[model samples]
Target: MKLYLRFMGIHFRSSMEYKASFFMLGIATMIASLGGLLSLTFLFMRFHTIAGYTFSQVLLCFSTIVMSFALSEVFFRGFDRFEQIIRGGTFDRMLLRPCSLIGQILFEKIEFNRLSKVIEAAVVLAYAIPRSGVIWTADKILVLILMILGGVMMFAGMFLLFAGICFYTLEGLEVLNILTNGSENFGHYPVSVYGKWMLRFYTFIVPLACVQYYPLQYLLGRSDRSWYGLLPLAGFVFTIPCYCFWRIGLKHYKSNGS
Candidate 1:
């Protein structure tokens, strides 16, 4: 933990050295996030509800997922861009260090700019929470928090999986973006609104719905199942397989020595 904080502080100080670039990137990210929110707003203006979900309800879902994705981007960005580290021979240098590989990768590049999305998500939540008409209780609040945490884990797992794939190919895969960034772009609304098959795929395969859809039903008073609130915990299982794949990839890695 102390090492992690030290790395974070070092990165923070380094980032601050280029304050203009840092703030520019942050503003750009924040604006990009707001574009999605504005699109939703325009759609809601045209039709007040989407698949029977009120605009505010959808906003809640949006805020939750976006917040989670932002958190993952901020913390796990090294994994997301691991191909660069591999190509630059940074991974090999890390292997010679006393620190854990995961720790080194995690702290390699801390993109604080991604916090812009988090701030935008917070603003959306502040606006949507009361208007969504969900009664807040301790359990419900806990469930909401879990939903965000589950989404973060799910996204981090995807980033790890992407990094692992690079070990064999030694190049970034664009198609996997469909699962990472693509999910975030389209996942603002409840998964059920897409289709039964989409919902099933997210639930059983990627477990995106486990964090966003199933538990959201309970949060929105659409379902009375208490178990629904706990479904987000199931999403954590996604990390196990991703981690296993990463280990396998690490074993097979043949460094380019760049």
Candidate 2:
């Protein structure tokens, strides 16, 4: 963990070297994230509720997904851009290093700029919390934390899956973006709003509903089942298969020899 922090520190310093560009990009990211919020606002102006969910409830869901995706980009962008390292001969050098390949690759890129999106999400969370009408309790608080952390893990797994695929294809796939970025965009509303089949796909296949929808139901007091609070843990479990797939891809990897 100390080594990871060191890597983060190094990336932070490197990003700070170009302060203006960093701030500009950060502001740009923040602005782009706000567009989703604005659209949601306009939507609720016409309809009092979406699929029986109030604006604040939907905002809670949106903020969680955005915050999670932003956090993943902040820490795991290396996986998102893994093709660059392979094509630039960096992967060959990585193989020669004594450190863990996954760890090294994990910190290959640290996008501090995405912190802007995190901040935006946080602001939305603050606004929605009091208005959402959920009776806050100790367990609800814990579940909320789990929801966000679980979301981060799930998105990180997606990024890792993308990187693993790159080991074979050596280029990023657009379809995978539909899974990652598309999810973030669609997730602004509760997955349940998307209809039964799509909700089932996200729940069973992507497992997004485990982290967001199920736990959200518990948080909103719609379900009294205590087990729903732990649903986010399933999102953490999702990383296991993704990591195994990554290992499989690594085993079959051939050097680009750049």
Candidate 3:
């Protein structure tokens, strides 16, 4: 962990050298993320609620997803653009390092500019907390935080799956936006509102419903037992298939490239 931090510090320093560029991109990203907030605003303006969840409730969900996704994106940016490294022969250099391939991949890119998403989501969370009316308990709040972390891990796994797939095709792909950006689009509202098929996809396929919906059901006092609060932990299973896919892709890379 110390070595990883040191490596990230180096990347951070490199990124800091271009201060103006970083700030500009950060602001641009901030504007785009804030613009996304309006989609939820407009939806609430028309219906006031979805699947029994209020505007603030929806905002809270969005906050968790956007904050966590952006956090991973900022640090794990190498995975986000893994093809660039593969194409540039950087992977060969990485293989020579004593560090783990995954750790080196994580250290290769640190987009400090994406920190704006964290700030923006925090602002939304601050505004939504009081308005949502959930009596904030320590355990409940802890569970809520875990849900955010789980969301980050799940998305990071998706980014890794996307990165690993690049090893096979040797380039970035866009259809993955369905799981990454596409989930961000759907996560702003209650998954329950999306009908049966969407609910099943979120539940069994992507596990978005596990992280956001079932656990949220307990948080809002709509649930009788507190056990539902921990259900988001189930979302971690999504990472298994993602990692398996990554391993298969890695083997394919070695076979075809050499």
Best by lDDT: 1
Give the alpha carbon lDDT tens digit for every residue of 7-68 in model 2. 99999999999999999999999998889999999999999799989999999999999999
What value does the lDDT take at residue 107 in candidate 1? 93
Clash total of candidate 3: 0
lDDT of each: 0.92, 0.91, 0.84
Q: Give the better candidate number (2 or 3) by lDDT.
A: 2
Arrange candidates by TM-score, descending: 2, 1, 3
How does candidate 3 score on lDDT? Answer: 0.84
Q: How far off is model 3, as Cα RMSD?
A: 1.8
Ranking of all predicted structures according to lDDT, beginning with the best and ending with the worst: 1, 2, 3
Candidate 2 stretches greater than 4 Å from native: none
Candidate 2 at residue 98, lDDT?
Answer: 96
Residue 91 alpha-carbon offset, candidate 1, angstroms = 0.8
lDDT of 2 at 187: 88
* Candidate 1's TM-score: 0.98
Model 3 clash pairs are none
